[model samples]
Target: VRLAMGARDLENNTVEVARRDTLTKETLSLDNIENTVADLLDDIQKNIFRKALNYRQEHTITVDTYEEFKEKLEEGGFILAHWDGTPETEERIKAETKATIRCIPLAGDTTPGVCMVTGKPSVQRVLFARAY
Candidate 1:
C-alpha cells in the first residue's frame, strides 16, 4: 500500500537490492520480491472472499427475521450485525464470542444501546471477527 522509487532513506540497510526490518531482523528486497509477495497475497485474499461470497450468493438462502439472523450467526461465516462503536461493547463482544472488531465496513448505524453481552453502551457497527 506504499509506493516508492527508492526507499533507502526510510529503510535500514540497503545492500544493493535488499532491505532489513531493523527491529524484527527480517531481510526483504524491494521493487520485486516484496511487491510480488504483497500482490500475490492480496489477490489470493480477494479471490477467496469473492469465491465465498459467490457461493453464498448462489447457494445460501436468505431469511426474513432477527431470529433467523441469530440462527445464522450461530452457524457463522459472515453476518451483518448492528453495532454502536463503543470500546467496551467491542471488547465485550470479542470476549464473549472470541471475535474482534475487523473493519468498519462503509458507514455504520449511529444508534446507541447497551451491548448484548456486556450491557455496556455502544455507538457504531464494525465487523466482529471469529474466523475459521
Candidate 2:
C-alpha cells in the first residue's frame, strides 16, 4: 500500500491512497487519515494472503504414476507424488524432468504408498516443482 500527498492536495485537505495488491487508488480526506490507512493496510494483508492460498491450492496436483508425474511436470506447479526416499531416485527425477523435491510436507495426507518411479515403498508423498 502507498500513500501520496501532493502540495496542491495539502491546500485542499485531501490525500491519495493506493493499494498495491489491487492497483486501485482513492482520494481521502485528511481527517481520520491514520485510521483509514491502518484499516486499508490490514485489509490488503488479508486479501494478499487469501489470493496466495487460493493460487497454491489451485496449482497443486497429485499423481500416482511416473507417466502422470512427467505429464503434469510439463504444465508446471507443485506435484505431490510418492518418492522412494533415496538420493538416487531424487537425482533421476530431477535429471529426467528438471523438477526437484521442494519439500516433504508435514501436513495433509500422511498415508503411505509406493514410489511412482522405483516401485519401492514410500513413506509419503513429497512436493516437486521446477524452480522458476
Cα RMSDs, all models: 11.4, 1.6
Best by lDDT: 2
Q: What is the lDDT of candidate 2?
A: 0.95
The TM-scores, one per candidate, come to: 0.39, 0.89
Q: Which prediction has the highest TM-score against the true structure? A: 2
Candidate 2, TM-score vs. the true structure?
Answer: 0.89
Tens digit per residue, CA lDDT, model 1, 1-132:
232334663474332322222212233454466666576557657877897779755543333333454466577555545554567655666665665655765654545554445444545434444666
After TM-score superposition, the amount by which residue 88's alpha carbon in candidate 2 deviates from its true location, in angstroms, is 2.0
Task: Note the residue pairs that clash in candidate 1.
Answer: 83-124, 84-123, 84-124, 85-123, 85-124
Residue 56, model 2: Cα distance from true site in angstroms: 1.4
User: What tens-digit string does per-residue lDDT give for candidate 2 at 4-39?
Assistant: 999988999999989999999999999999999899
Q: For residue 71, what is the lDDT in candidate 1?
A: 63
lDDT of each: 0.51, 0.95
